[model samples]
Target: MSDARPAREPGRRRLVLWRHGQTSWNVERRFQGKTDIPLDETGVAQAERAARLLAGLRPTALLASPLRRAADTAQALADITGLPVRYDRDLIERDGGAWEGLTSREIRERYPAEHAAWQPPGGETSAQVAKRVGSALERALDELAPTGQLVVASHGAALRLGMSHILGLPEETWERLGGLSNCCWSVITEMRDGGWRLAEHNAGTLPEPVLSDDRPDAGT
Candidate 1:
């Protein structure tokens, strides 16, 4: 297997959407939406390891959610790369409202209809999150240099929704993008046509080139 990172085309920028390390709530499978939870011991270790690898990418800028779990995770990379972490409120996780502290099973039992729709009563809707988080990402990109790399440390749901928004994927098709595991990341690269392409998702290691039918040499 090649250990190379994804190939970057000229005039293209890159964004690494990284999820925060795990917390106690993550282990318990509790809804931690917008909660200010800190990283657990294991989470701290995970962040440190991931940071070492990310630092090697030499990111140009680091941005993160204001929540402690995400801030701390970003700090790990900051410590290694000497990059200042800029916190953005819009990058915060989805607000779970009445389902904030409930386990998945509990939410299913208590609010079956809402759970089926994956909406939390009184919480921000998926559209709200996608727009908010997506706008934040765009603002950050505006500040980046052409061909620069940005690493955004955020929550799982927030990153996924924001990515879908950036790629112009409709809400109904957002589910086609899978969730990122704790401390994993997804990479998006700018296209020559001014759009974005997902290079990698839910990945721990650096990305390698993808082989697909779309490639010119596919049948070779």
Candidate 2:
């Protein structure tokens, strides 16, 4: 299946923000922030499958968080794309502090208001995460070839916040961009006007066309 779009003008590029596949903690509903847990068996399979499809896009550069999960996912792409993986510490998941390794229910029970606000007692703020991740992404973009694509393997929240920052979305509207599922990706294309546009969000593969004989198609 191909999700390739039309070629862009010279110097234009695309960024593929890929979230790492599921981990053991993910299955346990635990907060995995900066935990450095390796991908579970299913996650490795998911990455391999997704890499096969993403390779069709002919990505030029591969970047990932230094954490094990993200690194392993990026390595899957590297094996297929022959692109060396570059690790960026800034791409790491949000530091959940005291919340790390704790289940959602545990966090809520321990710190109700903080959990509601989605902030840990001693953790990095959303704005701080956005800044670091956005900066790292810009650096990756600088290294990309004109008209090339960069595949970024990172965490769910990190990618969402980073993409929001890169797109210049206000903090209030950031939540409008939902989180990505494991092994899913969001694509950003450089616009002609020197800005970025979200070409795809939480995309796992090319959509299969729906066919129904009874459906009407009267308009040309």
Candidate 3:
């Protein structure tokens, strides 16, 4: 979900991962996954802006999560990049298990400590979610024969955990990067050392966090 399909040429690969535009569920601040909601008007505008922003990237393959929000964003990016859309389930948001359609406030108010939905059990914690996401992205890379430019449309919650995972941030950092805006992007680069590194991390997302590299804690 985080990585793109391979490009036609090899040597160095560049993958641009963009979180998808907003949905009605997103706008209303609800949990989404298998929710199958469409983007709102503002979300459409956001996709258009994202399309223009990525228009000149010349990506060879436009990949997206199977979810409608992500698929829709990928379509717009495809139109701009002149590439067809490819769907990957790994790109999908965490199952969210029993909390697919509830808000955090609702969950806390309703289920409280008894909430199994608070943290996924045998499902995906932030680390597990990112592992699968990174793995799914790697699979996408392998599928594109001979390599090609790639773009992926993802979601904010997953992206938050993913960014944390890629940057080696702590689990407590989850809330810090959780509330990303629609169609925003946070880039990461594959370092020469083979460890993927954060590049312009959270460049086009929300809620500013003044960083302190000295204390790489959950400050985001």
lDDT of 2 at 29: 71
- Which has the greatest lDDT? 1
What TM-score would every model get versus the actual structure?
0.88, 0.88, 0.76
Q: On residues 44-108, what C-alpha lDDT tens digit does candidate 1 reach at each position?
A: 98899899988888899999999999999999999999999999999999998998888777988
**Which regions of candidate 3 are displaced past 4 Å?**
1-10, 114-117, 120-123, 143-148, 164-179, 205-220
Candidate 3: C-alpha RMSD after superposition: 6.4
Judge candidate 1 against the unseen true structure and give its global Cα lDDT, from 0 to 1. 0.83
Instruction: Give all candidate RMSDs, comma-separated.
Output: 10.0, 10.3, 6.4
Candidates 1 and 3 compared by lDDT, better number: 1
* lDDT score, candidate 3, position 188: 60
User: What is candidate 2's lDDT per residue for 103-158, written digit by digit as tens?
Assistant: 86798799888877877879888898889899899878877777889999998878
| Position 153, candidate 3: lDDT | 83
